[model samples]
Target: MSAPFRDEEFESAWRELDEPQLEGGWQLFTEAMGVTIYRRYDEETGLYEYKVLGVLTSCAPARCADVYMDLEYRKGWDKYAKELYEKDFSGRSAIYWEVKYPFPLSNRDYVYVRERRDLEVDGRKIWVILARSSPETPWDEKKGVVRVTDYRQSVAMESNGACGTKVSMNYFDNPGGLIPSWLVNWAAQTGVPAFLTDMQKACDAYGDYQLRK
Candidate 1:
């Protein structure tokens, strides 16, 4: 479980990735309406899952964004169909969004990224961090369907300085169609954008309060 120690090929490819590559990846993601990323390896269950996250940053100030997807794992993908996702928070609720999952396996290949723009909110710039993750999944060439079974959560954040973060995510399921094509598109256009806008509003209000307090 956990992708066979990330294999030699994967290790080599990952090693080749530098900070520039990471920044490029961030830039590409920000520019796209959304994208589908496929991988094969679930270390915990020995199954593969497909994961997708979408974005509509062009409508940032509008706060109209969406993100969502499903996880299918062969080991027990069917068993996880009815499972639910959640967000966890505690302490200093006004300053940051703290989240976690009850099940440990839900933690893997988590992608965290965010973008910032100068806004009129109290005449300052605040950064937002949108986060997402899916249990790693290995593709099944024979069946042509990736399987996954895991829970995931997303959060949003904003910073007073250059280092703070904002995060959030949108997720859904479509079992019959091989892959949830429509859901992916909807998430890119609807879920992520809306939630991100909410995060910004929250940030502006909270940031002002924090500054005053």
Candidate 2:
């Protein structure tokens, strides 16, 4: 019924990343391809929350944000996206996404609400997109699919003058099933960068995709 996440939560996240520090239990995980990632462990859930900062030198901030929010375009580029669509719950809109998993593992799915904001602070333009899981949804769970109950993702973008867009992302999710610790660690260390690389390529191609449409 109400907003999935509070306005203060988004503001706090953006403010913490404004200067970008490694305090508050966040440890540096890896740095590659101009992206720096940090992870924090959740004691109760035994999951990790990741924070990443990078620069996408291929496009402007607004363009990057547009590509990130475009669900139709995502189906073409996102290899893991098996099924994706949007639905309206009462008056609020939510997204349904099913992600592919390796053989012998069930697919993971998510139902969440997302919001995008274009803001100006101190004469600098900023774009932010926030998403979090919604427990109440109209869609019934599909057999053989593991619905992720705990998921949150946020992105903050700003212009980099002549370079491109400076981006920061925070992510966490719990795939409900028996997953090995090694596999989770591997995904965190390797998967984040791989996704970012794919996103950059998608941004570069977005202009042509729009022209065709």
Per-model TM-score, in order, reads 0.26, 0.94
lDDT of 1 at 52: 28
What is the C-alpha lDDT profile of model 1 across 88-156, one tens digit per residue? 223111111112212422211122222222222354332222222222322222233323233332222
Residue 43 in candidate 2 has what lDDT? 96
* Candidate 2: worst-modelled 10 consecutive residues by lDDT: 9-18
| Candidate-wise lDDT, in order | 0.29, 0.86
Estimate the Cα RMSD of every predicted model relative to the unseen true structure.
14.2, 1.4
Model 2 Cα lDDT, one tens digit per residue, 109-189: 999889888877788788888998886777789999999979998888887677588888889999989987877876777
The per-residue C-alpha lDDT of model 2 at residue 2 equals 36
Model 1 clashes, total count: 39
Clashes of 2: 0
The 10-residue segment of model 1 with minimum total lDDT is 91-100
